[model samples]
Target chain A: DTAVSQTPKYLVTQMGNDKSIKCEQNLGHDTMYWYKQDSKKFLKIMFSYNNKELIINETVPNRFSPKSPDKAHLNLHINSLELGDSAVYFCASSLRTNTGELFFGEGSRLTVL
Target chain B: SQQGEEDPQALSIQEGENATMNCSYKTSINNLQWYRQNSGRGLVHLILIRSNEREKHSGRLRVTLDTSKKSSSLLITASRAADTASYFCAPFTNAGKSTFGDGTTLTVKP
Candidate 1:
C-alpha cells in the first residue's frame, strides 16, 4: 500500500489564483501534517491534525487553510495565492507518538507566477 | 523561531567512504529524526533517536543524540553512489515541532 500519497505532483499558476492540494494516508496514523519547503531548503510545518481535529496551526497566513474530512485525509487550499506560496509542499503522517517518525508524501510543487 | 541546523552545507566523498552529518537545535526535544531527500522528492525517514536514547542504529545508518547539548548526528558507513542525497536532521520539540535543517548535500562519486 502507498503509505502516504499526494496529488497534482506539479502545479503552475498565476498569482491571485486559487489552488488546492490533496493528501491521504493509509498508515493508520492518528496525526497528519502539512509542511512547506521553500527555495532556501527550509522545511517548516504549517498545520497539523489528529483524528480529524485541528492541533498545531503555525503562524501561517490565513490565506492557507487546511481541511480534514476524515482521519485518513487532509487537504490544503490557498486563496489568492501569492508569489511567496511557490514552494514544495509535503504531507506527512505519524502515530502521534512523542518519537515523531513521520512518513512523508512525495511532495507537490506549486509555482505561482 | 529558532530551529535545528546542520553542519557543513555540503559534502563530497568517494564510494565506500563514510559520511557524517551533525545537527544542533536551540530548544529541548523529546526525539530527533534523520531524513533523506533525493532530488526534489519527499523526505524518507532514515532513523530516529529518542531524547533518552544516546545511540541508535539501522543497517548502515547510525544516529546519536545528546539531549543535554541539544544536538544529534547521523553517520552513514560505507556510503555508495545510491546514498547520494540531501540529508536533513529534524529535532522534535514543542516549539520546534519536528523541523528540518538546511540539509547536508552529499555527493558520492562512483
Candidate 2:
C-alpha cells in the first residue's frame, strides 16, 4: 500500500537513449512534482503539475518531458539522454493545502553511459 | 543554483546524540521542510515549518525556521544508526515551487 509508486526503480542505458519512468499516486493529491537528485545529492525540482495542469516547470531541457495523462499519474520521458542526465529521479505528490508535506515515490535511478 | 543551501556537507555523530543541520536560503519562503534520503534512495519528508512559525517537531525530528535570516535548521534528537542518511532542506516560495539543497550526508555510528 504505497502512497506514491514509480516503475523501473533502476534504469541503465548508453548515450543517446530514450527512456520513460512512470509514477502513480493514490493519495488523491492535486499537485505532483518531479525532482532530480544529482551526484552531490542536490535535489532540484524539475516540474510541478496541478491536476494535470502545468504549474511549475523549471529550466530543464526540452528533451526531458513530463506527461500527466490524468491527475493520478505523471510519467517522465527522456529523449536522447546524455551522460549528464544520469541521476535519481523522484516523483512526489501533495495536496495544495498549507501543509505541503509531500509523499514521495521510491526514486528511479537512471544511469547514462 | 537552488534557493536553499545546506552547510557542513557532511556530519558524523554517535548513536543517542543529537544531530543538527543548517540551511540558508536566498529568497523569502512560505515554508521550509526537511527530508531524509537513504543512500541511493528516495527522500522521505520529515518535518515542515511555516513562515509564520518558528519551530516544529515530529517524532525525533525538530525543525526551526528563521524567516528574518532566511534560514532553517533540522535537529534530530537521540539519533540512531537508522538515522544515517542524507538530510536535505527544502524551501517553498509563493510561486508554488520548492527548491532543495545539496543535502548534508549524516552518518550515525552505534
Candidate 3:
C-alpha cells in the first residue's frame, strides 16, 4: 500500500475554474504539507498542517487554501485557476514536525489552460 | 520561497560512475536532508545529516553536512540507471520549516 496517496493524479481545467486535490497518508503522521513544483522545477512550500492545525503558510496567493480534516488528510483547493497555477502539486507527511524525513505521495499534475 | 540552492543544475554520468551534487543554504538549520524524485513521481527521502553530524551514509548514497558553511552534498556511488533522478537538498530551520533546493538532475546512461 502507498504510504501517502493523492487523488486526481492529472487535472486539466480551463482558466477561472476551480479544482481541488485530495491527499491522505496511511503512515499516521502528525504533520502534512503541500508543495508546488513549477515549470522551472522549484519546489515551493505552500502550506503545512500539524495535527490538523495550520503551522506554515508561505507567501502564496489567497486563492490557494489548505484544509486538513484530520491528521492524516490534507486537501488543497485552488480558486479561479490561472495558467501560472499549473504545476505539479505534492503532498507530504512526516512522523513528527521536527523530523526531516518526509513521505511524499505521487504528485498531482494540474494544468490550467 | 525556497531556502536551499543546489549547484550544477544537471549532471550526467554513466553506469558504475559516481554522481555528486551540492547545496548551499542561507540560514542556520537543525538538519539537512537529501531527496530523490523520479520522473512523474513524488520525492523520496534519501538521507539526513544533523547539524552536529558531518556525514551519513545509506546504501550507495552518502550525504555530508557542513553547518558552518551552510552547505551539504549528496554522493551516489556505483550509480545505476535506476539512480537517475533529480536530487534535492532541504535544510530545516530549528523551527522545523523545510525548504527544498531547485534540485540537480542526474542522468545515468546505461
Candidate 4:
C-alpha cells in the first residue's frame, strides 16, 4: 500500500478558480506537512500539523488554508488562486513534529492559467 | 526552523566517479537528514546523521557532520545514472522545526 497518498495528481485551473487537494498517510504518523515547490524546485513548507493540531504555519497568504480532520489526513484549499500558484504541492508525514525522516506523497501539480 | 544551504546548486559527474555535496546551517541542530528527489517525483529519505556523530556510512553513501562549523557533507561513491536527482539537506533544530534548502541537483552522466 502507498504509505502517503494524495488525490488529483494534476490540476489545471483558471487564475481566479479555487481548488483543493487531499492527502492521507497510512503510516500512522503524528505529524503531517504541506510543501510547495516552485519551478526552480525549491521546497518550502507551507503548513504543518501534529496530531490534528496546527503546529506550524509559514508566511503563506491567507488564500492558502490547510485542514486536518484527523491525524492521518490533511487537505489544502487554495482560494482565488493566482498565476504565481502554479507549482507542485507535496504532502509529507513524519513520526514526530520536527524529528525523524519524512515520507512524502507523489505530489500534486497545480497549474494556474 | 534551521535551513541548511547546500553548496554548488548543481553538479555533474561520470558514472564511475564520486559526487560530494555540502550543506551549511547557522544555528545548533539536533540532527541532519539528506533526501533525494527524482525528476517529477517526491523526495526520498537518504540518510540521517545526528549532531554528535562525525561520520556515517550507508552502502555507497557517506555522511559527515561538523557541528562546530554547523555544516554537513554527503558523498556518493561510484555513482550511477540512476543517482541523478536533487539532494536536499534538512537541518533539524531541537526547537521543533525542520527546514530544507534549494537542494543540489546532481546529474550523473552515463
Q: What DockQ does every candidate get?
A: 0.66, 0.64, 0.78, 0.70
Give model 4's clash tally.
Answer: 0
Q: Please, what are the lDDT tens digits per residue for candidate 1 over residues A7-58?
A: 9899999999999999999989989999999998889989989889888888
Candidate 2 lDDT over residue span A1-113, tens digit each: 99999989999999998999999999999989899988877788899889999888899999999999999899999999999999999999998733568888999999999
Off by over 4 Å in 4: none
What is candidate 4's lDDT per residue for B1-110, written digit by digit as tens?
Answer: 67889988999999999999999999989899999999999999999998889999999999999999999999999999999999999898875577789899999999
lDDT ranking from best candidate downward:
4, 3, 1, 2
lDDT of 3 at A51: 99
Q: Interface RMSD for each candidate model?
A: 2.3, 2.1, 1.3, 1.4
- Pairs of residues at least 3 apart in sequence or in different chains that clash in candidate 3: none
**Model 2 residue A40 lDDT?**
78
In candidate 3 the C-alpha lDDT for residue B56 amounts to 91
Which segments of candidate 2 are over 4 A away from where they belong? Answer: A97-99
Better of 3 and 4 by lDDT: 4
The window of 10 residues in a row where model 2 chain B has the poorest summed lDDT is: B1-10
Task: Return the candidate ranking by DockQ, descending.
Answer: 3, 4, 1, 2
Alpha-carbon TM-score of each model against the true structure: 0.96, 0.95, 0.97, 0.97
TM-score of 4: 0.97
